[model samples]
Structure formats: structure tokens, C-alpha cells
Target: MSRPVSTYRVQLTPDFGFAEVAKIAPYLRDLGVSHVYLSPVLQAVPGSLHGYDVVDHSRIRQEFGGAQGFREMAGVLAAHDLAVVVDIVPNHMNTANAQFLSVLEEGAASPYADWFDIEWREGKVIVHRFADDLPQSEHYTVVDWREGPGYRRFFDVSSLIGLRVEDPAVFFATHEVIFWLLDEGLVEGLRIDHPDGLADPRRYLDMLRDRSGGVWTVVEKILIGDERLPDDWACDGTTGYDVLNRVNGLFVDPEGRQPLVALFTAMTGQDADYHAVMARSKRDVIDLFFRSEVERLARVAGASVQDLVDLLVEMPVYRAYVTPGEPVDPVARRIVESAAPNPEIARAVLYGSPEAVVRFQQTCGPVMAKGVEDTALYRWYPLACLNEVGGEPDRFGLSVEDFHDFCAGMRPFTMTTLSTHDTKRSEDVRARLQVLSELPGEWAEAVRGWSRQVSFDPHLDYLAWQTLMAAWPISAERFTDYLLKAAREAKTATSWIAQDHAYEEGLRAFAAKAVELPIGDFTALVDRHAVANSLGQKLVQLMMPGVPDVYQGNERTDFSLVDPDNRRPVSFPCAPNSAWDEAKLQVTTQALRLRRRLGPDAPYEPMAAEGEAAEHAIAFGRGRAVAVATRLPVRLAARGGWGATSLTLPHGSWRDLLTGGLYSGRTPLAHLLSRHPVALLERHDL
Candidate 1:
């Protein structure tokens, strides 16, 4: 039997920090939660909501009630028999911390000189890149070495300094904090952050797990397709972006590609393939930001301008993967061709010429190839690059057969997710894109009507559609304000680097249009498509041979965009009229109960069935218990699409555990389920 996930993702805060653990402990126990997964509770920026931005590694954040509170929280968890999994950022620390800031103040002379990925050559700290995406004023130089704390770089305007985790001292300093938490019995498991950015990912993870003393460990790794995590590392599984892509891909209609391609072609008039367009766009982003990075590297190396370019252009994907070692693979060249079909597009956007192309490929090939080469990489290691380049999207030329094969391999560690702190859009937003799967006539008519009324740039409109395609269930009221926040977060990129205004306008227009629909209509739309998508995800994720994950606030209803929006603190509705809360509680309770009843002896395998209607659903069976799920479309089905079809139950009379109703005829499972999610039928005898 698999170790089921009865998980709860909590954001530690002063309001509920260690103080509220006693109250929630009983609540989690009652809800049957086996583990409490928490955001980083270590010392962080003064009011840092998410703990990923660490400042002081030695102590717990005092804002969240500090060490005493952490101890109390641990005690409460132990009392409830729940495990505590802490999120740790092994990759970098916040520049705001005394240690990190002091490094900047003292320059190369600082005791912590080797504590970061800094290059000091010309009597000053060096910055690798400038904000090409941001407006360039003397005040806003490309590299801001004298910023808030250590040195400043992009990742939103936040003063987050990327550490040279490859450095031994840096690794040990970061580990010291984690070890403190572990040795104190404050944490039972760890979720490593951004494994992709690390130069030697395996070394860090191995060191962490060994010192963990047999604690459960999972990396926040992002493997795109066919990429497997290094098996030798001590890890339970990834925080599942690979499984997310595969599960999401299964829902996309392969037949819908033609119309999408045509629509995009008409909008852009660019002859490039979808993959080429995406590649060009990504190249544009990197190149737009490259000047400053090159300048900083030059300053650090004390080299001439051309020498800096030469090194960057020739630097291996990792310091370890340089030409002095292994043979490059043939498949890497094929992957490059697959991404950039037009050399002109590549030249115009990414690389300036054939030489630049070779250099860029040299860097990317080894980075991607290392995973295929079976290096000590975590699972989802390739996703760092893949996710940025639109990992396995239908638009990026991935086929259903290819996608399904990928899914088949992930059965053991499949982690299905929609929105995480990392994604550009939430699942709800992406569901809106599934509207592309509808009848072309209807989809075209709706877009045309909206276009005529909105009066926005077509390019911006396309961006809006893309955003909605990635996330949905957006709150229209907060739309424009949020876009401004998002843009502001990305520094001067909006005004300077790309000169793009259509994105901001288009997002606003889309939000406005969503609000035009009545609340009833909106709810109905959400339930029909969003709910079905959620259920389908559960079927694909849970039934598959992996531990399914539910991001912080996803269980009840997820109407969030990327990052800070998705990372909003979940507030349980106050008493009496908390129907939404109650309903979520019921669904979670039933799912866990069903999992328990299946027990250690339950037999699990994919189910096979025939019929056009069955194609709309995915079926899974374990011995006598069979699960049939409805993969409904974006629009509501007329009469709810062939209500419950008959399943020849084995022997004894079977009861619908969800509805307390009897199953006798060929009634639709949807009908039997009513509003309840899955139908649970058991034999009358056993």
C-alpha cells in the first residue's frame, strides 16, 4: 500500500505561528491530516510573508513567535501524531541578513567573502547582469551592487541575492541552520528549494539527506519530459511539476491544435512555428538582460570586454560539464532543431548569428543533457529550463502519444499540481485556454465579440489569452491593480526592456469580461469545467502510482494567479454560513476515508473500458472497487453528458458511499454523485 498524502500546507505567521498550533492541531487530527507541510519558518526578512527569502539562518523568524513557538508547534504536531515537513532554501540566503549584508559592506575583505557567488576584481562588488527589462537611467544602472543588502538581481525587484551554493562555505553556512532545526527535533522532513539553480545539485541534496538522519526529503525539482531524477539521491520524490505537465496535457485535445495554430498565425502574421515563436520570445528575454550580466562578469574577472563575451559564450552548462569530460549526445542537437525551426527567427531574436547559436546551444545542451546522461540530478531537473520554455505544451509541438508515454513513466512519483509559487498562471486561468478545444465557430465568435468591445491591441489580446489559458477563475475586481503589482515586481522590464503595454491592458480587459458574466453563470462555469478538471486531476494523480499533492490553498477552490497571489494566506470562512468550507471538509474526508478502506491489500492498476462516453472519463479499478471519473469539457454538457452508465458490479449489491444511494441501473455516475465527487461502491459481502 502506498503512503497516502493527508497533507496540509500552512503559511507560518505571527497570527497563527507557534501560538495557534494548539488550536489547529486538533483540527488537523480531526481532518485526518497525516502531515503538516509548512512554509519556511527560519529567520527571514522582517515582514517576509513567505519564508523562502531567508536573512538569518541561525534562528527561527522572531515575527512568527520564534524558537519557543516552533517548539510548541512541534509538540502540538507530535501530540496530533502528524509529521512536520519544513521548506528549506539550500540555494541562497536573503541579502538582508547580517551575514550576507556584512559581506557587501566589507567587500572582498569581508569575513564572509566566500559566502556568496560574488566576483570582486576592480575594488568593488560585481553584478552579473543589468535590468534590460527595466528603464535605464543613471540611477537605475544595469547592476546595482550598492542596493538593499548584498547585491541586487532580478526575480522581481525583491532584494534577493543569489548565492554561489557551489561554494563549500556557502553550502555549510546554509546547512548549519537546517541542521539546527533538524537536531532540535523541530522538523521531520525538508523540501529543498530551486535545485535547478545549484551548480552541483546532487552534492547538496546528498549532503542534506545524509545529515537529515533518515528524514523524508523531497526536492522542489522541475523535470520537463522523459527526464528522470537521479535515483541515487536520498529523496521520496519531487514536488511534482513533471506530473503536473503530463496530467494537464492529457486534458488538452490533440485535435484542437490546428485551429489554435491558425488563430495564432492570423494574429501575429509570423511564419515561425509555435515552438520557434516561443523560443524567440525566451531568447529575447535572456538577450534583453544579457548586457548587464556580461558587463558584471567582465568587471569581476578583470578581463577585456571581448574576453568576457568569450567566456560566457564558451562556459559549459555547469563548471563540471566542460569539454574536458564527456561526449555530447546526438539527441541534444535534435532537441535544438525541434525548438528553433527558423534560423532567421533565432538570429533576429536570440543569437545574433550562427556562432552565437552554437554558443547558446553549447550552454543549453549540456544543461539539459546532464539529466539524460544520468547525472546526480534530482527528478524534474530539466524543468528549470523546460518550464521557462513552455514545458511540453501542445503549442510547443508535443503529441498525445508522447505525452501519455511520459505520464506512464511518472506513475510511481506523479505529483499533479495546477498553480504553485513558481507558475506564471494558475490552473483556473489555464482552464480558460482549454476553451480553444471548443467548436471553432463558437470560439471565434466569442473572441470577435470581445475584441470589438475591448478595443485593445491584438498582440496584447493574445498575451491575455495566454495568461487566461494558464490560469482562470480570476477575480475581476482585483485585476488591474494586480497587474500593476506584477509589473512593478519585475522591475523596469515593463517600461524599458520590452516596451510592452499590451500585456497590462489585455489582462485588465480579460478580467473585466469575466466579471460581465453573472455570479450564477460564473459559478456554473467554474463547477462544470474547473470542478471536472479538478476531479480528473485527482483521478490521474491519485490513481496513478504516486503521492498526490495539494498546494496550500487548492483543495476547496483555487482562484489564484501566480506566486504572491496564489500564495495568499488561506482564511477559513467564519461560522454559520461557511458552506464552502464545509463542502471542502466533506470531500477531503471522503477521499481520505476511501483511501483508508482500500487498505494495504488493495490491488491497483489502470482500468480499461469501451464506449464513446467512457472516453470522456478515465477509469481505475482496484480489485472489487472501480473508480470512473468524468473528464467534462470547458462548457457544460447538454443534460450532463449521458448520466451514469452501468458498470457490472461484481456479485453482491453495491452502495454509493458518497450519496448513501443504491446502484441498480445504467444511471449516470454524475447523476449518482449529485454534487458529491466520486462514486464509491463496495460489495455487499466483503
Candidate 2:
């Protein structure tokens, strides 16, 4: 099980199962990925679109072709020189899981009682159910849906119950099938989903590594600004939200902040301060959705519930990485010391009850997910491109030097991705939106025109305008669904638990009218620049320091918005439908193939550009391979279009893999990028 040079992520559903993946083996190989990264393949709740709601781990999903189908798919991939990397969910499982049902029926007397993270009180387990009248069970006590189940869960999803993988028996039992897959050489790598939710991620990973012979592993860990993965964690590196944010930031303009904020404030009549909006959203979610979780923590820690709530709302990162019995990591200690409203509570979390510390750490991740990524990101999105899972909307851009520093320190085998099953928008859609940061005034005027034609809630209208523009040509139905979801997630005009029917109806009508409005002209205005950004970002992502992953269908221009939309069935064996699509496909293919040749240990050096337009070019080298892409295309065009910019090659003749143009010595940027906005060059001594 060697590390993958790169992976192509496919969202496998009931319709597109292991057999369908096998059909794409030749295409994935031809497209140049070393492996096909499949979403959760374990049996999930029947017909689950995204397989995160796994129901059983002991069997391969029947809908996904079961054991036999998986074997057939693996054989085809192996024949094509491709491998497999599976997304595994160890944190939680669907409540309808057999073991969980047994727990419900037999409680403490059940053979599988220790498998779940349920808290027992007087031999009765409390469970949350959505019923007008609570049903009584001798071994279970049913509570209101709003109450936190007397058990740990994944985020606020009650239907997904947490697993007690900290127990050795539970870990081995749940991972039996996965271990079998590894032994049979059916899977080569593992992508651990939501490691932050684990009671002891470090210990869980240690056990996994010890048992599985340490095949290449990465965690779905979201690192905040300047937050580094703990060196002690037994994994390769993060799934690459850190790299995604930095790469996304390279194309954003810091200068656009003030004007964009002003325009957003005027249009939406909402607070322009991102931090304030996020803080308020955090507080609201705790009260509205996490009251039960807070109550449970308070009862366990003997700390005031309000203090715990305040601390959770203020905590900066997802988890503190407090390992209960072990000494708190310096980083975790510092974060808790800084964020805690009371020093006593901080001490409790740091050196208090093991159960208390673990619960607090688990609670922080859900709060951040529900608060910032889901709520505030939707509420105050002046620039929607910055609203990714681990991105900071207020932080506008990254300096070239800073970006290089970030890349230089990356773990070689760590996964670096621009898009995934979880991204709010696809890479191309964000590329289009990034153009708006450069042309805020034009965007503002277009929004004004659209607003004049059709209007909804101002809070939602601002986000709707951005979404509509980024994913233009989207159907009225698709656009309507996206807006409704955004509005509910924002929890401003409407919410999932509490619906505003009248406002939702208006939003539906608005979507239909807004899509029909004269919006294509505006999209056309930014189309060329957007194309440049798209190619520029794609080339950089594919050639950067880590193992880059191409989300399904993103090798071409994919203008999808959020999930269900982003997860739509991709037509395989795809051909270029347009010039932009062809250009993007060429870039993706050339870069991935070059990376495969370079291997994982190639040295990276920042290649500096000289002359007037030097700032506009981002050039880097990996062994004999070089990647040069234009940044801030609109600004570059405004500043006279790469007049005298030149990059000195590594003292040899070089051929552009993209266009086959030859170059040596001081190559002029204007000539190198004359054909496309990006160039992938290979040094050729001949």
C-alpha cells in the first residue's frame, strides 16, 4: 500500500456504485490519477445520498455492489494501474444500526452495550426522539427532540449516534471488514472522517496504525490560522483544508475588502464585521441547538453551564487536542487559556475529570461547524469564495512569499485538494466568484439591476446574487433549492427547524425571476478573467507540495453549488464541450502526469519573476518540472498585460507541456502565457 501520487474523488451513490467506478477506471487512468478516492463504502442507512450516515461496518454496502462488486472494481482499477483510498467513518453510525437497536431494546444487558457512547443513569439510557408523547421503555427513557440524547453524537445530528471506539473491542469489531480489505489488497489508503469527534484521536490513530501496518492515512482535520497538525498524531497529514484556503487566498484581492464590505452592507443591511456576525451566530446556535450538549457537559464537569457555553462560543479553533489523562499539549493549553472566560473552568478542562475534558473537546468542533461554516458563512458573505470549511472570510489574501512558506512546510504525502464532496461551491464556481473581488463595483451595479427586477429578503438576496453569478446558467429549480438551503442555514429569514413559508415562497419566485433576468451580460463581462483564475488555481493546486485530489467532474468547468447539487451524477468519459473546458482538461492532465513522473520526494523551489509585471506571475519548480500561472488576471490586464515580465529558467532549454513552446534563459511571461493563462514547463537539455 504505497502512497498515491494523486487521487480523483468520486461521490459514490446507490446509482453509481463499485461497478460504475470500475467503468471509469480507464478514464481515471487516462485522466492521470494514481487512485480513485471513493466516499464512505460501508453499508449506510438505505438510499443515503452521502454515505456518512453509515449503518454497518461489518459488511460492504449492498447498494454499492457488495463484496463481490468491490473485488471486481479493485481488479479493474489494478489492471489500469490505479489504487483505492476509502473514506472511513469511525466517529458515528446511523441510529438504526443493528447494534444501536439492540442497545435500545436491551440496554445494559445487551452484548453490544459498550459499543456506543451512551451514558447510563440508574440502569436507564436517555434517548432523544421526535414524538408528541414520550414512549416509555424499561431500559430507555425517551426525551424531547430538542434535548441532547444521553449519548454522544455527530454534530447536532441525532439520527447519527457516536461510537465508543476508545474501547479496544469496539475498535477491532467495527474495523474488521476494513482490515480484511487491506489484507486482501482491495484498499491501499484510508481517509479518516472527522477525527476531531473521536474521544482520543491520537490514541485511535495509534491503534489503527498498529493494527493496519500504517498504510498511508490522513485525517479530515480542519486547522485554523497558523494551527499545525500535532506531530504526535499517527497520520500522514490533514485532508487539506489548510492548503485549500491558502490556494484560494492567492487569487483574492485584499484591496477588495473595504469596497466589498461596503457594498454588502448597503445591499443586505447586515453587519459588515465578519467576527461579530460569527460570534453572534455561535451564541445563537448554542441556545437553539446545543443546549442539551451544554447541559450534559455542565453536569459532567461541575462547571456552570453559561460559562461553558460562553467558552465554546469564543473558542477559536475546532478542538483543543486535550488528551485527558496525558499532559495537555502546549498548543491546546494556550488556546484554552486564551479563550476561557474563567480561569477555573480552563483548569478543569485542562487538568480536571477525563470525561469532562474529552466532552468539552468534542463539543467545540460541532459548535464551530454549526456556527461559522454553516451559519455565519451564509449570513455575512461579502465574498463567497472565502466561505469555505476552514477559510477566514475577513482575511482577504495571502502574499506570494507567505504562500511559498506555507507550501514549503507541507508534509509531502498530505492530501491537498481544491474541491471535495463537502465544498460549498466547486473550484470553478469559486474561481468565477474570485473575479468579483477584483470588480466589486461592477458586481454591485449588476446586483442592483437584478434587485430592481426581483427581490427577496435582503440578507438572502446578497448571497443569492453572488451564487447566481458564480453558477450562472443554473436552472431555476437548482438555484431555488440552493437559495432556500442557504436561507435556512443562515437562520435569518427562515430555518430548518422553524420554517417561514411566506418568505420561502417569495424566495422561490425570486429565484425563477432572477435566473430569467439579464444576468448573462455580467457573467460574460467576467468570463475571460474567470477562465484565467480557473486555470491558474487548477495548475497551482495540481503541482503544489502535497498529493492533490481532483473532485469528480472538476477537471472541466463545473459550476455546481453545494451538496446534492455538487453531488449530481457526473457523466463519465467526458469530452470538452467548450474551449474553457478543453483548456482546463489540458492543464489537469499535464500537471497530474508531471507530478506522477516527479514522484513525492521532488524538491520545490520558488521561481522568482522579474520586470514590471513580476507580481502578477506565480512560478515554482519541482525538480525538472515548473508551474507558472497568472494571478489577479483583471488587475494584470488593467496594468498593461505582462509587458516586460520574465522568469529565468534553470539554465536549460524548456518545453511547455501545455503548448509545446520552447524556452530558455530569461523567458518572457507575455510570450509564455500568450496562448493560455498558465504554463506547465519541463526542462529539456536538447
TM-score of each: 0.75, 0.98
lDDT of 1 at 188: 68
Worst window of 10 by summed lDDT in candidate 1: 376-385
- Which candidate number would show the highest TM-score if scored against the true structure? 2
**Cα RMSD, each candidate:** 7.9, 1.4
Residue 104's C-alpha lDDT in candidate 2? 73
